[model samples]
Target: MPYKPQSEPGKTAYQPDVQITRLGEKIGDPVVPADFPHHILRFRNDRWDQSIGLHSLNDEEWLSHFGKFEPLADNLYPPLALRYHGHQFRQYNPEIGDGRGFLFAQMRDHEKRLMDLGTKGSGTTPWSRTGDGRLTLKGAVREILATEMLEALGVNTSKTFSVVETGEELSRGDEPSPTRSAVMTRLNHGHIRIGTFQRIAYEKNEALMLQLVEYCLEQYYGGVQTDDPAAELFAKVAQEVAKLAGAYMTAGFVHGVLNTDNINITGESFDYGPWRFTPYWEPGFTAAYFDHEGLYCFARQPEALHWNLAQLASALRLIADSEPLVAALEGFPKAYGTAFTQHFCWRLGVESRGFDEDRDLVVAAEKGLAEKTIQIDRFFFDWGRAENLAGLDENYAAFSEFSTLIADRERSRQPVSSYWQQSGPCSMHIEEVESIWDAIADDDNWKILSKKINDIRAMGIALRIG
Candidate 1:
């Protein structure tokens, strides 16, 4: 069934009486601003969707609904049309920008937090070239699910604001034949990317490149005060990207594609293309169909990010020496390690140590992967259950009984040993694992297990049995 978007009940009504900016006009003639194409568009209004009803308010309606001429205060954030270059498939393509998107406006949240409200699939611009500049409906659906799930898992990410179906049919080679399109409104710190730096660098636009460095520092890294802005810029960018690398690894997420174009200058996860949570720990498992070499595989994401950040640093050579950039790059491993540790600690419901236990956890997980062939989602989902404890008896009495469920149900015929053997050694480090047998020694275990279940449920994860 086709999905519907809904508005929230109590959201402050927003009416978008957008003011066209001169900086934005030069690169993309204004559908609302300059440099924007004539065919550019805003989403159509609809009311049936329960999910994004309030947020999905049309641009004009948003202005009227909020009873404000501008949802974002003027002169606060100059909406400039960004120009950038990128490498596509290892080949440098020096032309790209928000060809189908743009920075509409920026605003301060209730907490004085600054954020940009940007649109995707808003339509063509000078950078759109001959492309239709339309986004498939599937893309919008994917973004919503991706952002929601990532948030639940406690990852820092851009929030989805609204998705408006354009009522336009478009054909793209990559999408299902006869695809429908939509425009997405999303919130983020800034729409800048590493490709933004690459573009100006390739053009030898030294002035603009310096302007971008200053802009990024002021907009995203307001804390770092350095005499050399260029050096500070690359230094800050490198650290943020590395931190994001650690966060991605901890969540077992594969961004699938980490091209320079996808590396946001704000270090917020954006451009959700071919992303997936790991179903299992296969190093080569990939989410993007076009990633034939697995360059951005589950295991390769961190290194790929380092490489991308290096490219960004290389471009800074025009303004800053390479040595300082290299020095900043050296800090990546420690930063990434620390972030991943914190995230992993949260997921495991434990206090974090200062470094990664990722490799050890991966090794331990693989034992079960090889032995039980348990589905990744299901294994984590069911491991906390009472039935799982019943399978812990050393004599294999309860374990044998539990096997009937798997054996008779047709999920597996292999004994629990297949998986247990591989993970047994690692289990020694986990406290209370051996107690599973004793816990299940009588009915007392059920009461204890019930309390544990409720605790995890309160953590917003429902570990349902398969």
Candidate 2:
């Protein structure tokens, strides 16, 4: 069932705590479009809204805040476009900031965790360079799919809160010319990136760097000890990001761009662009067409993320001793390996056989799928429960020993309900995505896209149960 908008409007739980102190020139007012119409495509993530205490908002109220970019009752006025430098494609670029997006509002969730309502395709900012700061409608759709799929796969991802079709035509070289435009809002944990730190480090501002480090720990890692706070923060972020890399691998996802700017300090996945989920277990699968060197390919994601974390460590050198930072960096490999094994087991719906055996199981499963050209999602869904396995083939022999163990454990267990048993696994390959967009571009039909989202959500529920 489609989510229903709140009917009985009540007081909003708006608590804006604008923490980024250096907003002297970083903040900017949103430039309203001349003839843009706000047509809400996906209004209701009631479950997600409840988390942030936003379930009381009606349609008009939602449109007011998210669609019109109006400030919340007590939130920050004139949305702030954050300032930061980044290494784009391994090249340092100091001009990058919120060119098309800005931090619209900040609020505490039910758990009192700070969350940011950020925008994309809102309007041009001071960092808009020489290009128009508009997002194509198709790009917005792709982001919705990416976040939903990742969340279902147990990845720490941002939720696509709302999407509004801004009546505008955008010309781009990547897709069909004169594509539709949109403005999207995402509910995320934090927007602080490794590049945010690099910006402070670039100016050789040790005092500012130390302040930022303390701010991040207080906001994101409150339980972390304050003594040696900078080193502790780095280690915590490194471990979280390493787990994120593991989740990506298990889900067969390629983030496409793992630049320092895109790597969030919260270790949550956001800013989806040119992302692809592999159909088969191909290590060299690259999502971005421009990645000629395959630097951020499926197999190289861990390495890329490690390198980005190292860049973060380098930036932190301005605030802390090199010894502690190095120690934290050294923990990533173990963290990633452990997370990979655990996530792989979760996907397969099997009990982990210690770290060593679980790692062996992951390797065997990957090799088996590659040799047999087994569809990645199909392999996971069909074998999620050990009892589902029937006749084994030569390619399946690699996983037979572990399968036997799982079968023994689940011999008398009740079978869990799953969508995969009734239908093929939900996937968002390039072709299917283009076809969905083609319908929108040619016929203005949205039923197919809506159904796809529903199906993907069902699959997510099944995965969670398994």
Candidate 3:
């Protein structure tokens, strides 16, 4: 079926829910939104709104709900600040929670799966220690670019649903003297982080731990029929997290922060802080400037996420036996290997022959990338057209296996669209991101950003990925 943009969106089909509050005060705290002097709507994602049935909202209603923090119909009134503890940089930190954000609403997507609408830069809550609970406009812009590019690359990431500029000057030492402020709404699967489980276990609340596990099984992992729901849920989360790490690797994304709190149970990547796309297949690429030791570097992402999953296993032991959780942990490397092959094959627009051949294809592509240092996106784009392949020659045997493996497979999508026929692929390098922000900051020009998004969406459509 051909994909069609909705001529009319945001209909009354919105199916809202408030299941997060069912965990009661044990999971979160009710909090008020920050009052800002002004509210200027920056961006609203109409494509995603159609999924949640909020596409028809005019600018005023959009601002009223997202900017002013007005509650959605049948949604949480005073939004709840979720509580959790995380391992930051391999060290336990009980002080972390939803310090600057809170769950604003819940609804079902077009697939009828439960989804969360959360906020960033909302206001300070009990968890906001010392620092001001605010997000800079540049930060929001960076997130927009990151999520857009990641989504186009077939990564399971959060959508920056709405961004509204709030009139305020926030002081920060990182960027400039006083940066502009904004509030952003993130739409994703759920906010149940591995840290959520860790907090329950840290408190030695066995009943709450059981409750959390049961809720996860019922809502997130409903297909698991095992008697040991906790164990099965841990295994399912492990699989999903492995797939997420695989996506990051294939997308050449460095999350920069993969703490336990940042690893959601659904494996949906969110909270884009200091993220970077590798300029090429630079294995040691680090996104965050503060990562002195490169703790969460590009190649070490799987390790970082595995460590986080271990923390979740440590927490799940309150209800599940240690053996099953350990077994699940032991399977991370295998699961990651399978997912990386599948994702790599998909991105290359090639049909998979099997696990062995797919893995071989991936190894060949990596060798090809390493030998010539071909930029990741350009390699993918050039692969679609044999005429544009600059480095894949029989004279160089490093990419010969790659050429042979690719020759046996056929294109995944027939009659490939012209998006791949362009002179270049849509990419989100740090320089391009900074240039987009510079446009907005210098001339208040949003046209360049808008065009980039259109180009990315066109590429995504051409890629024909879910």
Candidate 4:
């Protein structure tokens, strides 16, 4: 049966207030492809749709908006390919923007929080200077896995809204050549990047820079209040990004690309290009194959994010006073440390006693993992269980201090299940991902991939993560 909308179309709380694209030359406008064949709906996140009030979109409507890149009614039309410049691998690049993707639409979710539907492999844009604007099916699958796994791990991340297979062949140096093509949409809080500010700063347009800062504050930082709104916005973003950096550390995930362009103002992790989760706690782990210098390595992620936040501060300086922006940047290290400790405790399913105890627990946990050479997921899975941690070793003495705290905490709304008692926690390792793709690529089978997603979702529920 063809999927049908559970609610009325165009009856949504659709707010098409697009501020970035409204700035004419500040960003580039791009149109959707007219000839690409929209073949099949490979994936759709109806669970996420419920939160955004987009569950009413039927399959045909979904294909139209996601696969064919049709503009949402009363939303952003003639989707804009955002323009920005960034430092790639610590080297400044002047000519990089949305090459194969564009901002498709924006809306207010049920909570009235602003959300954007950004596309990948939608088609060629003005930014696609010397390359074909295309995305491989494998790449789309990887993104879906990355977002799902990260979300399950309680990391603030963009949700893979939809993935549609576009019937076309594409050649690539990475993965198999003449691979199938796909178009994907990610539902994120906002698309405003640090590079957005950097572009105006490069052009020396203080007026536009200030305007951009104001737009960001109105959209993302609506709750923030201060004498200097721009400086307050910078401080808020720095704190959010610092928390994000801490989440990455606790989750043992490397985003691979920490470029300024990839760092969004909302500090929610998006753009999963070459992301990977470490099998073990290894600081020097690098996800991208081309990252020969390990510039954005696992341990160095905090450093890279701090650097990106600094760039944002520099851009903000074109409008705001330098002292306040510098002051905002100075808070990153402390903010990251605090967030890391909290997130680490959350992963262990223990209530943190306090900052000092949490810090000591995190230190002990890391030392335990290193000494035992334990699998990251296994460690979390075992530690998350109260029963498993009831009898702790001397190595886990610090964690044992939280035993009473864990027992005293409120029980989860959901009942405990056998999923947590499994041999190992759900993980999206490279080998498993490639194996799932091999089934689809070689035999046209999606069973394994689908099952894996379901299993991952189950793990999220078992772990009490939203």
For all candidates, the clash counts are 25, 0, 2, 0
User: What is candidate 3's lDDT per residue for 1-466, written digit by digit as tens?
Assistant: 1111112123347889878877778899999999878999998997788889888789999999999889998878789999999999888999989989999999887777788999999989999998788999999988988888888777888899999999899998878868889999999889999999999999999988887887887777765587898898999999989989999998999999988999989998999999999978888999999999999999999999999999999999888899999999999999998888888877777776767878888998898878655788877777755532355544345666687778768777653588866878888898998999999989999999999999988877776632
> Model 4, 64-156: lDDT tens per residue?
888887777777777888889888887888888898888888877766678888989988887889888989999999999998888877788
**TM of each candidate vs. truth:** 0.69, 0.91, 0.95, 0.91
Candidate 2 structure quality by residue, lDDT tens digits, 1-466: 1111112222346566666544334223344432356556553565577777777888888877777877787776667777778888899999888888888888887667788888888888877897788888899889988887888787889888888888888999987788898888998898889988888898897877777788788889985486887898999999889889999999999999999989999999999989999888888999999999999999999999999999999999987889989988988999899888888877776666667877877776776777655678877866764363475445466566556545643322123665745755788788998888888889988888888888888877776653
lDDT of 2 at 65: 76
On lDDT, the stronger of 3 and 4 is: 3
**All models: lDDT?**
0.56, 0.78, 0.85, 0.80
lDDT of 1 at 52: 27
- Pairs of residues at least 3 apart in sequence or in different chains that clash in candidate 2: none
Off by over 4 Å in 4: 1-22, 388-415
For the record, the alpha-carbon RMSD of candidate 2 to the native fold, in angstroms, is: 4.6
lDDT per residue as tens, model 1, 144-261 = 5565555444556776665655566778887556765667767666677888778777777787677777767775787448878988988777767776786676456787778888
Q: Between 2 and 3, whose lDDT is larger?
A: 3
- Residue 143 in candidate 3 has what lDDT? 90
Query: Which 10 consecutive positions of candidate 2 have the poorest summed lDDT?
Result: 1-10
Off by over 4 Å in 3: 1-12, 387-398
> Once model 4 is optimally superposed onto the true structure by TM-score, how far is the C-alpha of residue 10 displaced, in angstroms?
18
Which regions in candidate 2 have their CA more than 4 angstroms from the true location? Answer: 1-15, 22-43, 391-415, 418-420
lDDT of 1: 0.56
